[model samples]
Target: MALLLQLFFAHKVTALSILADMYKKRLIEDKEVVIASIVGMFPMGVRVVVLLLAPVAISVLGLKLGIIYVLLEVLSKFMVALIGVFLDRKYLAGGVLEYITNVSLKNSMLDAFKQFFKVLSILVPSIFLAMLLIDLSFNSLVSQISIETAHLLIVVTGTTSTIAGLGVAGSLIATNEVDGKSALLLLMIASALHRIVESLRFSMPVNISLFGSFGVRLTLILLLMNELASIFAILGLFLIINFGFV
Candidate 1:
């Protein structure tokens, strides 16, 4: 239940901090707690919402490509999370199973909610600042970008900085630089390459601050999982494109 809530309300650092707290408190006795968190922190639904609202995603990609993008993200995240769950099972101690077996469903739900919100305070400030940054300068940021690697820039720049990629892709589409299917494929690759640099800034410091050396390892694991998911998505995209299903 904790993992389910985390998956739905994913804020990576916040989720990790909460998990780290649970570990410290011994509320969770699993050595693969990190994996458990990863399984639930994919942000699939959140990204779909973002895609729907973001001007860049809508204007450049259009409805079809936008839907494709959402599908890819959802599928990739789901696949990766499922894999993490399976891997976690290998390391799970009997205690968690026993705890689950003994606990009432109502109590389990309540505890999951409590654990999930333990780091809400940490997330709120960051959310506000990020929204502020986007409101103040997102248009300007997107407007100034004129680059060929728009897709790559999108992923590398992280979610907040996608305005730049939006501008670049929008321009490219306007000028007939790439067709919709082609652009979709390019963007697909970029999406798969995502959070590369942004993860360092947002993920590294927060994880390290909360979990110390363990946080470092955790951050690395998170990055690996993201890349792995991206690879899986890109490969799927390739197959789809090659098969004329684009």
Candidate 2:
């Protein structure tokens, strides 16, 4: 179940659906689902990705904004720890040290490995397919963006995809068409606005189909939480830029 949680937890709606289903089935309580909502948004894999992307962001967003980007990911993780892990520790399970007295270490390890890999075989491929489809769709949208518009166009392109926007922003910055600070701000605006559009088209409908009214409710909560975070980030960035504080 820890492995399954690891798999689902990265995709926010997927995580919420699983957790919410658990609640409906009485596997866990409502607070477990709601409080751990941040985990549905950030998850463990995303934290790893954030670290991996830090240097790339530095090169694209430059030193200051890049650091801010990393901090945003950290903020999400911190929320998960405070809200999710604190409320529900069941997924943490037991370690070898903790299980040492209860069972044969060799048998335990062998059985655990077999069970984990058996589930992994099914889930890993499904996850890969989902990721590939999403990437293909986003890449198609990104390919449509024209970086020639520079400043304002960066925002438009960003609404298509952040990766697309970042590439466009980098080009504009290179040509001295837009500054790092303004580029980052526009990116945030595009990202925040895009989130709304995406929810309406994809997540909202899909979730409602699966979980009905509960899905609508959960979807809204997650969207609101994420949007609020983006709002604060934008305001914080604005202040730093305006004050020349980097």
Candidate 3:
């Protein structure tokens, strides 16, 4: 699974390189683009490594500490991004430092505050609408399922299908001690299938065809998740775990 995800990430990086090439003034050098993509893959690698090593870590460190280490490792990428941004500004022309120096701090703060509120304005209502829709749909479709299944349904279909939903669902799972495998599976499926409404909302203003974009994205996500390589990788992890290899 991790290997497949890396391949998908590489594909995205290739697309980004193509897009950069089309611009008259390239933001990043050709070689640097590939380097950046490889560097970016580190987080995915960390995720896989942590999951693979989790059993051993939990046994050695205890579950709470082990989970904390895993979370910190995942979040460490943000530090890497921060350092990358700093380097870009220090070494590259027309980087973020130039823009930062040009803008007034007060204005920047005000703009950030406005944007925060603006996002909240959109998000609060969308969340309520999503909740209402999920309530209606689940009641109609499968009202007799267990509480865990109900939560999974809400997470998959009743929230934004992007990173926002991932955070929300992850928090719920952690708090409720939900089955990790089930939560991961549902989250992946949700990421692929849901968010159509959000995608349409963003794409319409840019004149992109909603159906075309959604179809392509959904197909790619499903394909990557279901690919034989990914399946075998996941199976390998299970086999190792079952054999007490950790």
Candidate 4:
């Protein structure tokens, strides 16, 4: 396993290096390209870790439910990636620049946004996958989660990821000339405030049926059914291999 992991990491590093060169050739113009490259690899590392722990994550769903969870995980990641791409184009490049400039954000803030999007393209999927598992753990109807809380989670998680991504990007942008601690502190503060806001939102919908109770329960059933189908798919894959049908 260790050797396999090392080999997997080696490929990731090689890929990162290749991507760095590609950026250097096309987009990256600063001296901080190397730092950007290193930080850029963080999401790759995160994905690898998640895959390695797939068994544990699956355990929560049971073998049957687990397989379904994996598919949902994949679907969620795909959805997030699609959204990230749109975000990257619409906001990361243009909006981020405008937002930073108007707010008088320091240089690191600018660099961070560039880096954050690069990583977010990868991180969003992981987040999406994690959320499905979270739903499974909670087992409540999707509607049971208040709209305020739901929106809050989306905002908090999105903002926090954005800040962290930007910090890494900024560190690379500065090539260590800027203090890492200071940049990190700023990121933390931004994310912390977002969290506080989310907590406040969590309490705003008491005694209010955010969605109809019937719709909420129906959505849960559909989700459960989808999960079961995934388990059968995994079983079919295993059976195919056992029968040498491939």
Candidate 5:
């Protein structure tokens, strides 16, 4: 049963990848609708299937292989989610053109879906990579390191991702035809707004839901190259944990 389940999930991953690659370059009549369906269906499907089979695989493969498999699964989904978000947002929100014309950042319904994909893309892979790298470093310097090392790695990865994201945001705004300074100012304002929303979540129920929804929605779209960094992180972590730096 365990073997069968693993095989099933592996096959599902393959099929989903094929579909994503197929639609990668194609433009559809309804970009948002198609992108939403793809985003909603693919990662969730992979997540559910993997979660179900993971325990069984873990028992069979031991901690090392088990973690590796999970890392790969998380990273792959993250990449797909990132790409899906961009594709969806571009289609639904009309990309840079609409954003500048409207001067409003509130994403539409379809945009929400894209956002979720973008956040997930970043969160899943980042978390996995952090886990992997800490494990590796710990093993390499097994005598010198402590358990706190793992937690420290998490902090580092999160901070790095945030800083990198800010850089990307600034670059995007600067490149816009609108006044570069103005674009940067608008983006900074938006970031401040998002921060307020994040803070208010603790005391305000409505704001909590709003930011939570926003966070989830935003995951649907992230830069493609960031996804690769996440993959490397996961691989590095797994190597450290599994092999030890002997």
Candidate 6:
């Protein structure tokens, strides 16, 4: 829910900026840009709504039904995009669909392949190093630290190396007999905020500041999940999974 809200507002803001830029550069008329932004942001807004409803849907209906709803929502967005592209053809001087079908598809595929290799190169080595560290008695070192200190270390490791951090946390959870509440808190922080390094790597190629992405994600994680309330929320989820509601 939090992630969806964040992404939803981000997309709307980005669409507004894009429209302003387009109008300023005379790339499109004001009316056309308004329509285009609305069309583009519709899916993002719907995603927020769908995610907000997911918990209730899953609880009442079932996981399978909830997943089906998400898939249908996504497919509906795709249909809307297709329809918008076709409808806007006249406004775009008639070749937009063809260009998107051929040139854009090729470029997107090439970029996706490049990104896959790039991410794989980083992730594989990180995972190996994480495994190596665990075998070297790193967990023993962490066991000696105070619980608060351990949590801090986990968060730091997560920010630096995602795989290593997860490995360390898993080891601690399994062997240390850590408190369930604390373990859940640490897991939430590590999993959600651990992508700081990956975000930096991707941001650089897109001409975005690494710190900007890192700061935003970190802030959001802390704000949303770093509290007693969040711990209770996790407890609720744990209960739901283990016992279900009567």
In terms of lDDT, the best-performing candidate is 2
lDDT of every predicted structure (CA atoms): 0.57, 0.58, 0.41, 0.36, 0.39, 0.44
User: Higher-lDDT candidate among 3 and 5?
Assistant: 3
Residue-by-residue lDDT tens digits, candidate 5, 68-181: 544544555556556667776575645221111111224333444564466557655654554455446654563465634433332333244432223333233333323332
Q: 1-246, model 1: which lDDT tens digit per residue?
A: 465344335444445556666777777744466666567655633543453324345655576665676566667777888887777767665454222212245754565466445434323443344345444654456556754343433333334343444444445555564566666566555554446665787778887787677777777887788778778778877877888877
Q: Model 6: runs farther than 4 Å from truth?
A: 1-20, 23-103, 147-154, 161-187, 191-246
Candidate 2 residue pairs that clash: none
Q: Per-residue lDDT for 27-124 in model 3, tens only? A: 44533432343344344436433433343334433465345434433444444434445555565555231111122447545654664565456445
TM-score of model 4 vs. true structure = 0.24
Question: Model 4, stretches more than 4 Å misplaced?
Answer: 1-12, 26-51, 59-61, 84-246
Ranking by lDDT: 2, 1, 6, 3, 5, 4
lDDT of 4 by residue, 23-79 (tens): 445543332222332232233334432543234324322344334333433443343
Candidate number with the higher TM-score (1 or 5): 1
Pairwise lDDT winner, candidates 1 and 4: 1
Q: lDDT (0-100) at residue 51 of candidate 5?
A: 40
**TM-scores, one per candidate:** 0.66, 0.61, 0.35, 0.24, 0.28, 0.39
- After superposition on all C-alphas, the RMSD of every candidate to the true structure, in Å, is 8.4, 10.5, 11.7, 20.9, 20.1, 11.6
Model 2 C-alpha RMSD to native: 10.5
- Give the candidate order by descending TM-score: 1, 2, 6, 3, 5, 4
Residue 34 C-alpha lDDT in model 1: 68
| lDDT for 173 (candidate 6) | 50
* Model 3: how far residue 98 lies from native, Å: 12
How much is the lDDT of residue 141 in candidate 5?
61
Task: Output the worst ten-in-a-row residue range by lDDT, candidate 3.
Answer: 95-104
